[model samples]
Target: MRLVVARCEVTYTGRLSAYLPEAVRLLVFKADGSVLVHADSGGYKPLNWMTPPTVIEDGDGVIVVRKRAGRSEDRLEIRIGELLAEVEHELGEDSGLEKDGVERHLQEALAEQPDALEDGLRLVRREWPTEIGPVDLMCRDADDGWVAVEIKRVATIEAVEQLSRYLEVLRRDPTLEACRGVLAAASVKPQARTLCEARGLGCAEVDLGLLRGAREPELTLFEA
Candidate 1:
């Protein structure tokens, strides 16, 4: 991941047109080929962003991101006035998701048998992409409708919010506009359940041991 603090202006043209005037902002160029421009005060949302499968041209204090969007192209241009702190970090393939051992294992287990969460639920893919981030899993229901699944070690309000964001972006695509979200976790909080119900999302408290054949993974070498 490359983080650059710069005084710059951003303009986007594609499905729509938007611009951000010159100011000090944070620009993130991710290993996944995503680019994000953020202001300091907007909570966690970026001011402008472009997702992966993009070609980025950078030189002479200007950066241009191009993507082939169907019959046309989308472009994001950044004009750098001053480049401040710029540094890159090597983050592994995790992509800031599935950070813990148990969560990672649970995702793998669920990926193998998605029907454990719901009947006829078969995985289309894992780490399904969106602008905000990737969904834990993308699946198809018995009716062949799109299902977006998010697995967490513990489900909270924030987790529900994360899944909601993924769903929002996915629904923008005409093919996935009817998509729904499901949240599976080792532990699902009451507040999270309430939020899921209100948002019309499904929630299941996944039993990790049961999913793994009634045996929890051995994380330690020594027996107590």
Candidate 2:
């Protein structure tokens, strides 16, 4: 069996919801500015824009499609109501199409989501551990103390509580060399931050702005 990996970056200009009542369009260009295929609106339109077949240059503001067969194509087309469908799908049948009190980001996109926690761990690699449970992240610093991180989008009290539990478990582990626990998130509650300090656990606050475009989060160590 052969597995094909699609390498494409999504640069969203408008809304990323499937519930939005508008059509979404994408422009695909070949390496030489040639148009190969335009698939959108449940149909495929071939060569409607490009006059000649050419190589599309890298970073040309167009979606470039490459296949293992050495064939490539590009298109300028709309995804029709795919975005709206996706949004609706995220809500599911039980949660109707109400947008007033619904979450803007998908549940999987939230910090509590496993993927988000893993992503945060990638940013804090120096502290990664070989074996750990389903916690977001586990790492060791120069001091050889364990740093267990839990990421949250909204940085609520519950997130801190969850991290606190993970820390408690780590503290009891005889194999874990470090005795300190760290809780990190996009934001942190005052009480949660206070509790961490009172409990002698390390605390780190991550800025979403820094995580967006910055290379990584800067760590400043202080004696706890």
Candidate lDDT values, in order: 0.90, 0.42
Q: How well is each residue in 1-224 modelled by candidate 2, as lDDT tens digits? A: 11112222232222221121232333344233334322255465531333233333333333332222113233322222222221111222343233221122222233333224333232234224322224555554455545666555555655666566566455556776354565666566888888878877666655544434435666899999
lDDT of 2: 0.42
lDDT of 1 by residue, 18-135 (tens): 9899999999999878899999998987999887668999989999999877678899999999999999999876646436988889899999999999999999999987776778
lDDT of 1 at 191: 99
Whole-model lDDT for model 1 versus the true structure?
A: 0.90
Per-candidate TM-score against the hidden true structure: 0.59, 0.36
User: Which runs of model 1 end up more than 4 angstroms from their true locations?
Assistant: 88-117, 122-140, 143-148, 153-181, 185-224
Q: 214 in model 1: Cα distance from truth in Å?
A: 11
Name model 2 segments beyond 4 Å from true.
Answer: 1-133, 214-224
In terms of TM-score, how similar is model 1 to the real structure? 0.59
Clashes of 1: 0
